[model samples]
Target: MFKIMIVEDDHKIREIMLENIKKWGFDGLYIEDFNEVFNVFLKYEPHLVLMDINLPSFDGFHWCNKIRALSKVPIVFISSRDTNMDIIMAMNMGGDDFVQKPFSIEVLMAKVNAILRRTYSYSNVETDVIEHDGAVLNLKDSNLIYNEKKLELTKNEFKIIYLLMKNSGKVVSRDKIMRSLWEDESFVDDNTLTVNINRLRKKLAGIGLSEFIETKKGQGYIII
Candidate 1:
């Protein structure tokens, strides 16, 4: 099922949209920390977003611009401030569509499904493999291919590597890394995360991609 990110801070609207999203056979994730909305976007990698114009920290336009930098995902703005200027501004800010406040959940769902169908139905496929130097990560199958060798990875290992490769050239802090790994409860200490990172690196180096990841002092780890 496709995942939808709900950035509406209003409790009632958020629940309405979430319920309809599930009913429509899509997954839903509600934003908890408005300050780290972009982080949520990266971690969830939702196919689309339902956003409100006003929010706790940053507005929908600001988050839209940031998301556009990382993804081509669709965004639909939901708000009570309905006006020509609001619609115009929303579109200019990279939003795909807009829904005024007090909308029927049915109508909202229709718009959401239509936008997703349009976006995904006509796009050319990106290369399944991401390559650097001679090493490649087969995104389709979670396999590492390098120097005439293929390395298999567990689900957790694949997720770790995917995050590293996706954000290559930047140090990913331990907290962020752990958040991606463990979405709730079960706190993973820094030492355990380090061990897993080491194991993953060795698996990569066993074939050819040694020095694939680097430890940034007091920062975190990164693959570059």
Candidate 2:
């Protein structure tokens, strides 16, 4: 069974989520000390994490970055902050998905199940590496290599680049990319995708692979 860590502060919300997580046959771990969020994560080493933006000591973004630095464990942000900037910041901070408060438990569980399946089950058959234009995407470690230099990618960045590199020389539509990245793409903001792509391009450029991913306006994105 997959272990899921809950980093939410509210007592009522945490209990609700805990009940449903157990109902789904997954072990749920909740944090009691906000200051030791990362420490708890290290001790538990959960397969996935459910985080909320408004916490006690540090915001969710800070903890997200701390966890992201060491592990690529799937993280979903659950919060009432519905602003575009909040969503974008969550994505930028390395969250795998975002759920607004007042959300249906059923929908949240669906997203959780979808992400877990994609992360664990689908990975069983995927090749460890994908190469294009002399740049190699290391699937196992989520690093991109080119000219002997390697750069680690965030979860979203890895998925976006992996999709583009897999369909190298082909125009991948925006809808397609969004679906590939977020299983339930309808809840995702359009600008969120742009933010991920731009961040990815900037990272690629850092390794001297400037213009590695091109924008094919009116269509989508391409890597050629």
Candidate 3:
């Protein structure tokens, strides 16, 4: 069974989360030590994490960053802060989704199932959907689609797209992309980065997303 980790402080809410998670048939664990949240994370190696924004010492974003450092396990924020900034912050902090306070149990479970299905299914499921106007990057099959056209992407192409798409309009430095793609390598030349960007752009154009990638001169690139 898939394992889920919950990092909520409130006892009643924690119990509710545990019960709901168990009802979905997935094994779940609650963080007992607020200080060593990451320890429970490592011990469980959960497929997903449910984090609350408010904690004893650290906020959910800090925990999310720590977990991201260790694993790419999907993290979803369950918080009472329903502001737009909160949601955006959650996404920017590596959270896959957000559940506001006073949310329906059924809806919460549905979201959990949706995340689990898209994340861990046996089929060629996508890592996520990167939306840019009419264009969408299919993370699973490494396909870029727009106006009914489909462009297949290579491993590097997919990685670049994933990173840029995650950031969207934000300028993603070439170094950032390189770090994600060639982590073990200390150096990746400018030509390599340019080539990857060119290839990705061409593939996107084939799918009618031409001019979708914006160059920022000395900065980097973005899907605007």
Candidate 4:
């Protein structure tokens, strides 16, 4: 299922949109802390974003620019302001579409589904690079670039860092990491995974990302 992130601040509207989004068989994600919108977007990596014009701290346009610098994911503006300038600004800010407030949920869903189909139907939507905290993972080259230094990674190291960076604020368990490696035909056992993690950490530290990935006791590892 496609994941959609809702960035509206109104409690009632946000909940309502989420309910309908889930009802339509899509995974809906939202955040209450508006200040962390960009970080949350990076962490979740939603396929599309429903953004609002007015927000706490920074506005939707600010976050849209921030995200646009990183990924080409679709962003649809949903707002109470429907002026010509607002719509133009939304488009200029990299929004794929705009839906004004007091709008039909069905219509919104239809637009969302249409955009998703058009965006993902005939192409791979993953970005060429995944970046966090100044470290850029070049998917095409399997190189980790930090502070103008590039470090080549083995297949297993790439996969491990990809998973960790993709899920940046969450703990990824050892079993999950092992499963991912196994799917890639690496066949890493528990001890092997530990070794890989250690090696990857050392490489990251070498490139000025020391202590980037943290161990979470018995749970797993997290890149926060």
Candidate 5:
């Protein structure tokens, strides 16, 4: 089932939308901390979002732009404002659709289904989630989750983790990691690879998974 995030602040409206969302067979998430809206969004990684324009801290446009930076997940603006300017801003800020306020649950679900079908029907790729030692690496969004703690990872950090995890019990040489990262060892910088490894290790440690990636003096690194 597709996950939908509701970013509305109004308690009544949020509850109503969530109820209808469940009836449509979708997992609905409601935001609690308005200050960390984007952070919560990254943690859930919902397929789509129903955002309200007027929010507590920052408005919907601000959060829409923030989500755009992270993923291509669809975001639909639902607000009482129906001005052309509001609609245009929503689209420009990466909103896939704009639903005016006071909409029927039937109409809302219709729009939601249409967008889901149009976007996901032609896309057959599934997001891969790799789990090891209580840590899950979300390949779809490049975020690491450990014991309920979420950490957003960079592209290289993700690639390094992927390589190591694929060969869990084996030692992956530094050169092999560099080759895997760039596909060309000659173009790889020795220092750059070390820096990325250290950063990746630090991030893992931050989530209480210290020494998750074990480094061998003469050999290389291993996750064992």
Candidate 6:
């Protein structure tokens, strides 16, 4: 089932959207903290978004742009403002579609299903898999597989392995590794980097791949 994240702040509208979304066989999530919308979005990784123009902190356009940076997931703007400028700005802000407020739930469902079909039907094949030794990292699902054992990885861990495995035998710089993490991890100190790397290594070790990620001391890490 496709997951639909609703970023609408109106309590009644959000509740109705959630109920109708579930009834139509989709997983619906309503954002509680407007300021943490992007964080919640990264965690949920929804297939599509229903966004509102006026929100508590950042408007829907701001959040849509942030999501666009991290993902190509479809974002459909649902707003009361029906001006041509609003529609144009929504599209420019990476909105897949715009639904004016006071829409029928059935029409919304139809649009959601249509976008899903268009996006996934012809392009459901998984991409971005990197392999080093016998270990394979699936960037799509953020998981690692080695010797037929599958290990789930957090977003940070996946980015680390992706960078290392993409450059396989080369030493990826610590600074580069830190920069690769999705959000504000660039400001994190060295010890935090060490902790994340160690945790990732331990997870790999648990799956019997102890020497998968090699450290280059004062330099960085390499996958060989």
For model 4, residues 148-205, the per-residue Cα lDDT tens digits are 6888999999999999998999999988888888865355557899899999999888
Clashing pairs in 3: 126-140
Compared with the true structure, all predictions reach lDDT values of 0.81, 0.88, 0.80, 0.86, 0.84, 0.84
Better of 3 and 5 by lDDT: 5
Output the number of the TM-score-best candidate: 2
The candidate that wins on lDDT is 2
Please give the distance, in angstroms, between residue 203's alpha carbon in candidate 1 and its true position after superposition. 68
TM-score of 2: 0.55
Cα-based lDDT at residue 132, candidate 5 = 62
Candidate 4 wrong stretches, greater than 4 Å: 122-224
What's model 5's lDDT at 116? 80
lDDT for each residue of candidate 6 in 1-224, tens digit (9 for 90 to 100) = 78999999999999999998887677989999999999999999999999999999889999999999879999999999989999999999999988888775655665676677768783553334555554666666888777668899988888888888879889999988888874565567779889999999999999998898898988889887
lDDT of 3 at 1: 81
For candidate 4, what is the lDDT? 0.86
Q: Clashes in candidate 6: how many?
A: 0
| RMSD of every prediction | 17.4, 15.7, 12.4, 15.7, 17.0, 17.7
* Per-residue lDDT of candidate 3, residues 27-51 (tens digit): 9989888999988888789998989
Identify the runs in model 5 with alpha carbons over 4 angstroms from their true place: 122-224
Models 1 onward score TM values of 0.54, 0.55, 0.55, 0.54, 0.54, 0.54
Model 5 alpha-carbon miss at residue 208, Å: 61
lDDT of candidate 5? 0.84
**Residue by residue across 1-224, what tens digits does model 2's lDDT show?**
78999999999899999999897788998999999999999999999999999999899999999999999999999999999999999999899999888776655766677688778985543344566655777677998877668899999999899899889899999999999888899999999999999888899899998898889999999998
Model 3 residue 53 distance off true place after TM-score fit, in angstroms: 0.4
Clashing pairs in 1: none
Clash count, one per candidate: 0, 0, 1, 0, 0, 0
